[model samples]
Target: MKYLMPFLGLVALLACRGKNVEGKNMGKEIVEIKKENTSQGVDTLSQEPRLKTFKGLADTTFVRLADFSDGFAFDLRYATENNFLKAKVYDCAECYTRVKTAKALIAANKDFLDKGVKIKFYDCYRPNSVQYKMWEIVPNPQYVANPDKGSIHNKGGAVDITLVDMQGNELDMGTDFDYFGKRAYHDNTDLPEEILANRKLLKETMESHGFWSIRTEWWHYNLSAASNDKVANFKWECND
Candidate 1:
């Protein structure tokens, strides 16, 4: 009987020890699960979208306009063969400009959005090489800028743009882009009322944003502050 009691007590001890071991293992698993949840939370925070800021960037530094704002639309005619050059000078279609120019453009676009329209870009900063290529094709000072002299476009100060409705349809400015005739002139006021009104909206809005229009082309605007900037040859990468 004594032996039987001792054996039973030993069995009870072993059972209690097994329970303790299982409890320790369960505690370890719970800690591991908590750690995994924390890691997942960090990953979720990191994946959240954060807008790029122009806080510390220099005014002359070139940046992709789309990276800073997705509100603007891009056509980038020079990237296609539809331009006056009839050749694809840019490897890809991208809108890059000086930081100051981008800031002004974003502000101007916000104002445009309030009017049920937005600015649509036909072209942005042009590399010096692309300017030379354009000069080679046309070689006309009235149409294309002399590459050696470098236009506002090569200095990241000029943008060819037009207004588009919220539906993405371009507002008529009397003539299509790259038109070199008197019909495309801003001073030619003998057009339809709607076209004149559209041009007025574009010109006033852009001028308020520190941009000035050329007398010859209604679609061209140059940032007044960027006139002294050196011409750039910065190029963008294309996706495979």
Candidate 2:
């Protein structure tokens, strides 16, 4: 029986692999993209189990984006006291989004990586409970969305992000994330050309991947398909 078990395990391992979703440069494939820095000539790719974990997940299922690809970066401000709330509401720093939103993010990251940059997340998939917490900190509808009427973040469809060069340096977007002012508005054009260019890159690429940007926050994006998803209260457990 011991020998049979080993043989069966080997068969299972073999059967679990070998399905490669061929990727192209325009961002169709998820983990198969071997991004080469257009200027520096650097590249990366990995065919690991994590990349296939989404195979059977429903599009509406909330998932950790990192589980599917290592092509992006995260800051997760709300996990720390760096955000506008000036409070650490989340117990841990993790980025989760609905499967559909995640796929769009992965596709957007692929395009960003090709441009020698990647998306750095500030926030993703906030629990509706956290929304109430944020609202308690700032009840104004101008900044914090009313928890009574859940925001897109609670729906696992919104992301607060910015671009980081391959060197892990954030691009100059004219203002830090969660900044509340005219400077952060998407229509605010009184900025330097470089800053505008950087924002343009992040905006246009995300738009191409089915995300729409809000008028007031350049860092915010919402998946058009996830607008109607129910507000989720699933809290993440911190691993010791």
Q: Give all candidate RMSDs, comma-separated.
A: 6.4, 15.6
Candidate 1 residues 1-240, lDDT tens each?
988999999999999999999999999998888778777774422465567999899988999998899889889998899988889989999999999999999999999999999999999999999899888888999898999999999999999999999889999999999999999999999999999999999999999999999998999999999999998888888886
Question: Against the true structure, what is each candidate's TM-score?
Answer: 0.80, 0.79
Error of 2 at 150 (Å): 0.0
Candidate 2 lDDT over residue span 185-230, tens digit each: 9999999999999999999999999999999899999999999889
Model 2 TM-score? 0.79
Query: Which lDDT value does model 2 have at 215?
Result: 94
Q: Mind sharing the TM-score for model 1?
A: 0.80
Give all candidates' CA lDDT scores.
Answer: 0.93, 0.89
